[model samples]
Target: MSNQTEYAYKYIRERILDGTFKPTQKLIESQLSEMISVSRNTVKKALLKLERENLVSIENNKGATIKSFTLEEVKNYLEIREALEGIIARSAAQHIKDTEIDELEQLLLRMEHCMKQNQIDEYSKLNRLFHNILYNASRNIQATEMVSMIKTQLMRFHFRTLLIPGRNESSLNEHKMIFASLKNHDAAMAELAIKQHISNVRKTIENNYQYLL
Candidate 1:
């Protein structure tokens, strides 16, 4: 894609992922093109790419809207996350280098600082980075992509997870456990830790977002 198309794509995608666009919100090409200072054609191309990734839907009459997940779809995302994240943690534990472990520790320390400062948005970004780094360390291309796609879909609800009372503390502790297991190269322990972490988050969403479900 050209630079303008790429820019439009990224700008719209970021809005949807961050919940600025909102699920089921109509995306007007003229508005997006004007907002991004690109041609409508470029915006159209960007929306097409997003549709292919299941981030948006376009119809002849409806134009485009951010994709909305049903309760069942949300459940499937978490279930898939649980299964794939376990394998990712195991692979990371087996293959993570000493330097990589050090990097992860640095990330944890920063995340702890975010928690102390009550920086929910910053903490959320670091939380994402921590997991992405772990998956990258696993060196499994297909698994990483699968996890990334599900995560992209789940981003809309992620802020809700972080905002829940006491969830930050619990999530931080869970990360510590996963980090410790990875550092020790304990594959089984790492897999179990990651699975439990995903499961906990799933339960939190189920309890709090009954309306969505």
Candidate 2:
């Protein structure tokens, strides 16, 4: 891809993930081209790439629109995430560096502070960073890529989960358990802890999906 196309891709994808572009919202190539200072053809290429990532849809008559998911699709993605994250946690326990573990510990401290201060957005950012560190430590590029792609598609719903009442405290506790298991280099416990964390998030979404909509 050219630099222009890459920029257009990141530009559109970020808006979609951050909810600036609502689901099913039409993506006009000419407008995006003007905004990103790229050609309409370049915007089209970027939209195609995003479609492959499941973040956009293009049809014969329709140009492009942000992809929307059904509740079942969301649940399916979360279930896949739970299994993949468990693998990541297990591998991270075995291969993670001391410095990486220390970073996770410090991040957990910050997350706790965020919870106490009721900084949901800040906590959510930290939560992504926390998992990213684990992803890097896991040394499994394939699984990491797959997890990230799925995450990009579900980013909006994931943030909504954090907005649910009492979810921050529960999420923080879950992260602590995951941190403890990784710090101890206990692969099985790490896997279990992370799986449980994702499972709880899935259940929370299932029970309180209205907030997401």
Candidate 3:
């Protein structure tokens, strides 16, 4: 892709992932082009790329709109994440470096502080970084890419999971367990801990579907 198209793609994709461009919101090429200072064709190309990523939809008559998911679809995505994230944790336990473990420890400390201060957004950012370190340590490129893609699709819902009452504490505890397992190089325990974490997240979302939606 040309630089202009790439720029437009990142601009639009960031807005979508960050919830600025909400689900099912229309994407007008001309408006986006003006906003991003890109040509309409560039915006169109960018939208097409996002559509391929399942972040947008384009139809015969309609130009483009942010993609929306049904509850079942969200659940299905979480199930897939649970499986793949478990594999990642297992691999990370075996392959993670000492420095990576230290980094995770620091992130966990920061996360705890965030929880105490009621800084959910900052905690969420740190949480993503924590998993990203594990993803790199796992040395499983294919699974990492798949999980990352699915994560982008579910980014909006993922952040809201922390908003549920008492979830922040529970999530921090789950991460501590996973971190301990990885620090000990216990692959089985690491996998179990991460799977349980994702399972709890799924259950929380299911029980509080109305709040999440």
Which of 2 and 3 is ahead in TM-score? 3
The TM-score obtained by model 1 is 0.95
User: Tens digit of lDDT per residue, candidate 2, span 87-176?
Assistant: 899999999999998899999999999989988899999999999999999977888888998888889888888888999999999999
lDDT of model number 1: 0.90
Candidate 3, 1-213: lDDT as tens digits = 999999999999999887788898999999998999989999999999999999999997789999998888888999999999998998999999999999999999999999999999999999999999999999788999999999989887888999899999999999999999999999999999999999998898888877765
Number of backbone-clashing residue pairs for each candidate, in the order shown = 0, 0, 0
Give the runs in model 1 whose Cα sits over 4 Å from its true position: 210-213
C-alpha displacement of 185 in model 3, angstroms? 0.6
Ranking by lDDT: 3, 2, 1
Q: By summed lDDT, which 10 consecutive residues of candidate 3 come out lowest?
A: 204-213
lDDT of each residue in 27-127, candidate 1, tens digit only: 99999988999999999999999999899999997799889987667878999999999998999999998988998899999999999999999999899
Candidate 2: clashing pairs of residues = none
lDDT of each: 0.90, 0.92, 0.93
Q: What TM-score, over all chains together, does every model reach?
A: 0.95, 0.95, 0.96
Pick the winner on TM-score between candidates 1 and 3: 3
